[model samples]
Target: MGANDLAKGPQMRTVIFDLDGTLADTSGDLIAAANACFRGLGLGDLLDARHDAGTALRGGRAMLTLGFSRVDGVDPGEVDRQYPVLLDAYARDINSHTFLYPGTMDAVTRLKSAGYAVGIATNKPEGLAETLMQSLGVRGEFASLIGADTLPVRKPDPEHHFEAVRRAGGDPRKSLLVGDTATDRDTSRNAGVPSVLVTFGPGPHDVRALSPEATIDHFDELDAVVAQLIG
Candidate 1:
C-alpha cells in the first residue's frame, strides 16, 4: 500500500504493535535459543519449547533466569554471562520456528489501506528485531521499528512509544498500541494512549487485570479494534 513512504505526510492516526506474541508468535525460536545456552552449559534442553514459551517471549534474560532457578549451585552471574551466547544463538537462526500469527499481514495491509500509519515498538533488541522482521519479510510493512536499545529507555516508558509514532509520521496523541502483556499495557497508559491487548499469545491473558482499553482474541478482530479506538 506504499504506507511507509518517508516523503509522505503523517497519517491522522497510528497503530503501533509489539512484535513478540502480538504480530508474531516468536516463542519457539526464542526458547530454542535459550536452550542452546543451557545445552552449552551441559544443562541439556532445560526449557520446554511449549511449556517455557511464555518465558521465551519475555526475552533471553528471563529465560536464563528461569532455567537458573531450577538448578542448584549455579553461578550468580550466569544469566549475564550467557546472555551474549543466547543472543548469538538466536541471531544465527532467528526465524527457524517463528511465524506471523494468522491474519497478521492481512490486518496490516488493511490498516495501511485505511490510512493509518503503522510501526513496531518492541523490547526485543533492535538488531535481532530487525533481523527477524527482514527474515520474515515484513520489515518494510512498518513505517518505523523501535527496540529496547533504540532509545535509552524502553517499554513502560512513554518516550519509546512516542518515538515510534514520530518515526512513523503519526501523532502520538492519536495512536494506540496492540500488545499481549502488562508491559505493553503500561506503556500505553504511560503514553496516555489507548491499548489493545491480544489473547492469542503463548498463554491466556488476564485482560481484566491488565485493564487496557480493549482486548482481541485474534488478528482478524484488530482492524475493527483499531478503528474503534483511534478513528
Candidate 2:
C-alpha cells in the first residue's frame, strides 16, 4: 500500500467512507484543477465548476477524458498526458473550496464514541487524500486511510475495501461502506457486506438507482442506518 496509514481500535464493526462525494464536497477544487490543465493546453476552462461537479469527483482522468471528448482535433492520449498536470494543480489548492458535508465530523465522532472503527476508502490518490484530510483538520478522526493508489487495485474491488477495514482493526464481514457512487455499492457487495449510499452527494438520483443496502439523506441519519445494517 502506498501512503496508506493504519491504526488499531477495539471494535467489532467498521464504517468505511468514500471521501470525495461522501465525506467532503471537493468538486469545486477538483474542477479547478482539471480546468487548470485544460487552460495550459489553451483550451480555457473546458469544465464548469458547477456543472461538471459530478465528473470532477469521478477522478482527474475522467474529467480530462470528458473535456477531450468535447473538442475536435484533441489527441487521444491527451487525458493521460494531462493527468499529472491536473494532480499537481489540484495539490496546489486541494481544499480551497472543499468542505466536509454537514454534520460529517459530528456523525464520525458519534460512531467512534460508540466503539465503531472508522476509516476511509477512496479512489483519490493516496497522497492527495492524506493531504486533504490533514488540511481539513480531520485526519485524526479516521483509524485507517486507504486511497486508490494505496493498493494495486481500487474500489469496485473487494480487496481495496477489505484492506481499509482490516487496517482499522475491524472484520470485513462486519464492515459496511458509506459512499455516494455505484462503485462503492459494488465494493461492499463484492466483499459480502452492506452499503449505505448518501443522498447528498453529486448525482444523488443516480446513486439511489444503484440500490445499495440502504440510503441516507444526511450524516445525521448515518448512525441509525449503520446500526440497522451492521449492528
Highest-lDDT candidate = 1
Residue 144 in candidate 2, Cα distance off native in Å: 0.3
| Residue pairs whose backbone atoms clash in candidate 1 | none
Query: Model 2: runs farther than 4 Å from truth?
Result: 1-11
lDDT of 1 by residue, 1-231 (tens): 466663365546999999999999999999989989989999888898988888888888999999989899999799999999999999998998999999999999999999999999999999999999999999999999999999999998999999999999898888999999999999999999999998889954476579989998878899898988998
Instruction: List ranges where model 1 is wrong by over 4 Å.
Output: 1-11
lDDT of 1: 0.92
For each candidate in turn, the TM-score is 0.94, 0.94
Residue 149 lDDT, candidate 1, scale 0-100:
99
| CA RMSD, predictions in order | 4.5, 4.7
Model 2 lDDT tens row, 1-231: 333332344347999999999999999999999999988999888888888888888899999998888889999888889999999999999999999999999999999998899999999999999999999999999999999889999999999999999999898878999999888999999999999999888752567789898998889999999999888
lDDT of every predicted structure (CA atoms): 0.92, 0.91
After TM-score superposition, what is the CA distance of residue 87 in candidate 1 from its true location, in Å? 0.3
